[model samples]
Target: MELCFGWFLLVASIPAIFAQDISHGSIVVDGTMTVAQTDDNFVCATIDWWPHDKCNYDQCPWHYTSVMNLNLSHPFLAKAIQAFNRLRIRVGGSLQDQVLYDVGNLKSPCHPFQKMKDGLFGFSKGCLHMERWDELNRFFKETGAMVTFGLNALHGRHKIKRSLWGGDWDSSNAQDFMKYTVSKGYQIDSWEFGNELSGNGIGAHVHADQYGKDLVNLRRIINELYKGSQSKPSLVAPGGFYDEEWFVKLLQTSGFGVIDVMSHHMYNLGAGVDPKLVSKILNPDHLNKAAYTFGNLTHIIRRHGPWTSAWVGESGGAYNSGGAHVSNTFVNSFWYLDQLGMASKYHTKVYCRQTLIGGNYGLLNATTFVPNPDYYSGLLWHRLMGKVVLNVESHASPFLRSYAHCSKGRTGVTLLVINLSNQTNFIMNAQNSINLKLAANEQNISRESFTHSLKKTFSWVGTKASDDALLREEYHLTPKDGYLRSRTMVLNGIPLELTSTGDIPSLNPVRVNVKSPITISPLSIAFIVFPNFEAPACG
Candidate 1:
């Protein structure tokens, strides 16, 4: 009677155990449903348009004077650059418009200008020397970064007598700058005309039609200057916040094939010092707010500029510089990784993070020059994610945001799962009779011993796998300890740090047996790679 009662209890508890309010989701990897083919140069960073003196890493024992002169040759920065294969560098920001190119040999290297009230905007009306430009080019050449130089277009704008109306701007100074660029034998991949001059604008405003006309003039000059060259660089424009009507007008006026990449800036968080910055990052809704802009831009591009690719030219999340501790810590990865996944899903070709070496949000610390938590997140994405994006659906909880893509060169798919809930864990499984049964049993049994064993399940419906082809790899990104808001990040329980010799440590992922459901802890992000599932669609 005792044995029979025990057996009966187990059988009756099956449904109750699995039915507990644990969120259940599924990832549908239908080959027919395809997202955009992500660009090989998808992960990009930036060097602000501001001068070196305005933003400098602390002079510690390392004795780094200026970021402009920071040894790109250093093993640390060099290796980080090389890891991405081809990381594009957007060398411009709010200050690009106020900067002047000094082609003449001037004895005074620094041409001082008034500091703007916003401290970070405009290069202080200073003259950037030819020597500095050359050094910058060398750094680019050495780092294998595709350079996009934002030219000073606002300097040429005139004060027309029309109220609430602006005239087409001139590009004579830009023309001179390009001519000098070609003469110096510096290969600029693209020339961006302006910065933050969109919609109502930031520091300065320009009418959309006027900006379009300026782009046409710049395009003509680029064509003429690089006539004999094998290939001319593209003309990128209006790097600023997305204003739908203004952007569409810019596209319509510029016409087809003029603007190569339709780019915009994103600083969703109102300010860097907002008291609720941490809560904002932790909130899934706040982080996913960018979807509106990404979706809107994609639609506009497809409607008017079908050939032009969409890109987030500069995104630091919080404007007026980023939050000191919040922007650079492990918690930011929740937003950073989610942004990458969301942007890619919405067909954003390139997502350039703001201030690669300056500000609090930089991947590398401004003072220590050390790689922050976001740096590893970027490196892992580059190494694990591929150009072909696959459809992923997580119906479990709003907190569990999922993205999938065919492994870069590997056979199966790589799934990026982000759990936004700080109090809930998640489980990811392949949706199949065999796997589902196994997952149910594992969850029911594991819960008996482990208090936090009830994980939100993500079941995927795709290609069938052989018993032998069930091997998977998982890279879990979380805080060094259990704390969600922290400065350090650990992958599979190991913190990624620079060696004593300033070298990148090996980022090893935890191997998993795919037959068993994978678990993702709370407030964490995981990259699940299925290498052995040879899906025909992925191929």
Candidate 2:
């Protein structure tokens, strides 16, 4: 009888046990002021040139996925790129400096990368044949992918010391490659010089002044190569870690208008082999650490190189090929999405992920060519997030992250809210800029009081014109399973997966009453679009 009574008690407590706690909060989206703006093709991914033998932490994750070996005929590959409309694809990596193009000039026979005892990253110089280059351009054309090819910045420069490289960059080979590209009628959006040749580069380092001089020469070559062309490519350089002194000199020496985009690489979460990788991704404090770099870069661009903007040329939360299990899983989306929103807020023009495919961090699976959770996140971001960033504040909790932007090609605002907490489902009320102005004029009411209200209505939109006007679209994203490490993503209540024919699944949202507070589930992200909401700035 005692056991029976215990069973009855357990059954009674199931609802409360499974339910999450509700925390009330306020989110004031000041749509009147635009905080920042990102590029139209803000969503970007990279296709690295790592060979199949590139191993890390006792694991070989990269397979036949370099520029020379990636299967261009793969249907998933083309569909994925086309999904972004015009996804900016950067082709470069650590080995980019050692790469030599086989386009023009009479030199030694071109060869593939071979294992070398003391070679940069343990591999000899790699070559890109003209045929392969033409194939890549044709693939880009078919997929409508914007290309930003990285030139061999270390070509013709002799190694001075351990990792220090000195001497002028030989532009002959690069010019020949550019001339061929122009002759083929390929459309390249930008030409990036070097990989990580700035501030004690990854495998090789170059002095700032020398790099600057070489950049000026590269600019001259570009002008000559594409003279009178309607669409002249922009120049981007110094794709490396952020070094205040090194970056300042590169800009000062190269001077303004020479470099169009100052690119940098970021691996804020440390190495991929760390055991504490997932824990760090969930920590708000750890994520906020990247703000210093982004904020500082914004200042540097506005002050030093006003002509050129900043781009997170390459960022994979945990570098060194990314965590084998963690990076490609759903948990990585927390870090990836947060960084994208944070970068956009800081006026970062473009943020290219470490890879489109190949590494463990690739948006698509290396073996199956399947879209991972982060892939869906990127697609939604591309389909939803507009260029204009809006000011959004959440006094709810430190764990809750909120970012608002004018809706992409729409008449309202889209609020991206990420709940890092595992137990608290936040209920927040969103107000437009009208509240800010109203509260500013009425001295009796405090700003805090202005944000907290039920059935908050905007004065401009006198009343609901139709039944749909009272609703907002909500896209709740969570792991397929309750586990944070799940590879699949669940949107609302349905699982996100590709069709049998390899087409990307359409992202659909459910409409919820706008008068009621938005209930964001714990450990989930909500992209709520207020289509009919009166956002004067958006208008």
Among all candidates shown, the one with the greatest lDDT:
2
The sequence of per-residue lDDT tens digits that candidate 2 reaches over residues 91-190 is: 9998988888897893856799988989999999999999999999999999999999999999999999999999999988888889999999999899
Q: What shift in Å separates residue 294 of candidate 2 from its native position after superposition?
A: 0.5
Question: Per-residue lDDT of 493-529 in model 1, one digit per residue for the tens?
Answer: 6787777788778888666556566676677788988
Report per-prediction Cα RMSD to one decimal: 8.1, 5.4
lDDT of each: 0.73, 0.87
Candidate 2 lDDT (Cα, whole model)? 0.87
TM-score of each predicted structure versus truth: 0.84, 0.93
Which segments of model 2 are wrong by more than 4 Å? Answer: 1-19, 439-469
